[model samples]
Target: SSVMVELVGQMKDNLLLDFGEAKKIIKEVVNVFDHKFFINRKYLKQEDDSHFQIQFEGPKGMFELQVPKNTTYLLEGEATVENLSSEIIKLLAPKMPSNVEAVGVYIYEGYNKGSHIISNISR
Candidate 1:
């Protein structure tokens, strides 16, 4: 299994600026968590015309909880979903500008195709 996290933030006037900031923030977040999990890669993805996301992939076993659609399930052992989700928001909160709100953090898990596992949002 593999783990992925999508960082969503408010859009700015310049798309490049938003993307660049996202990249930098992602790097810092990944570095902090790297000690606990092995991150494979990080990339910027356009969620829609107005939203862009910074997404990163890491090895499995990093998350102990998995929620697909409506059901919630627990895995063997690792980081709890709530802990990781909150930690990510905490790491992002200080780095982000006031205008650029850290809207949501979505975590996914799977071997081939990722399934929406858990998420945390700050409005």
Candidate 2:
């Protein structure tokens, strides 16, 4: 198991939706791991609620979910990257809004320096 990994999802457009949706999607992803992962919501009041993030930690590892105004959503941190990365796209793809045009999954091997773009989703 790697010490760190992050699973990220990107949205296509400027989405004005409820935070609940993001949280729900994240919870679903975490549930599949069958590991104890904790989530903390942050960046609520920054830039007119345009920036939102969720930090996750557990026995497997730790990762963060970041949603900014320009970008849809990004999940990154330290964990077993491969399984989590693919699962994120598989699970979140159906539920995303139409405005969310594309979603990509990247797996960072070893340290942050050793990484590659695994796949791209074009909507």
Candidate 3:
């Protein structure tokens, strides 16, 4: 049976200013959820043009998700950290197959917590 994933945002945007920093955070977030969620890193693949890639392996098989880097958005508004993991989860949940056994989400831990929240996926 597939499990449903839900994320309740608890913090404000502390968006990373550097692209490298942002990509690093996303990678860590993925590692966090890989275990119980059966999200194997070996199977994960990032987009050639962007770092925001979401990959998952389940009983039903593999799924990939990514949002093209919006340079225009970054240039217009100062890059502020957003709960990207939450955003991805919300976008992905409804589209996920019902047989997905686990759910994972990454939440920003506010500026005081760290540069970014540790990589994580929920089950």
Best by lDDT: 2
lDDT tens readout by residue for model 2, 7-99:
344534554334677667656764554443422223222334655555556588886555554443332433345545655666666666655
Residue 91 lDDT, candidate 1, scale 0-100: 69
lDDT for each residue of candidate 3 in 1-123, tens digit (9 for 90 to 100):
112223332223442123464345445544443322222234445645554465656699987766444421111122223344444454454433333333355344454442222223333
lDDT of 1 at 73: 17
> Which prediction has more favorable lDDT, 1 or 2?
2
Quote each prediction's TM-score.
0.45, 0.38, 0.23
Summarize candidate 1's per-residue lDDT along 15-61 as a digit string, tens digits.
42366766778678746654443221223332334333335345852
Each prediction's whole-model lDDT (CA) = 0.46, 0.48, 0.39
lDDT-best of 1 and 3: 1
Task: Please identify model 1 stretches exceeding 4 Å from their true place.
Answer: 1-11, 14-17, 37-78, 111-123
Better of 2 and 3 by TM-score: 2
**Candidate 2: segments with Cα more than 4 A from true spot:** 1-17, 36-80, 105-123
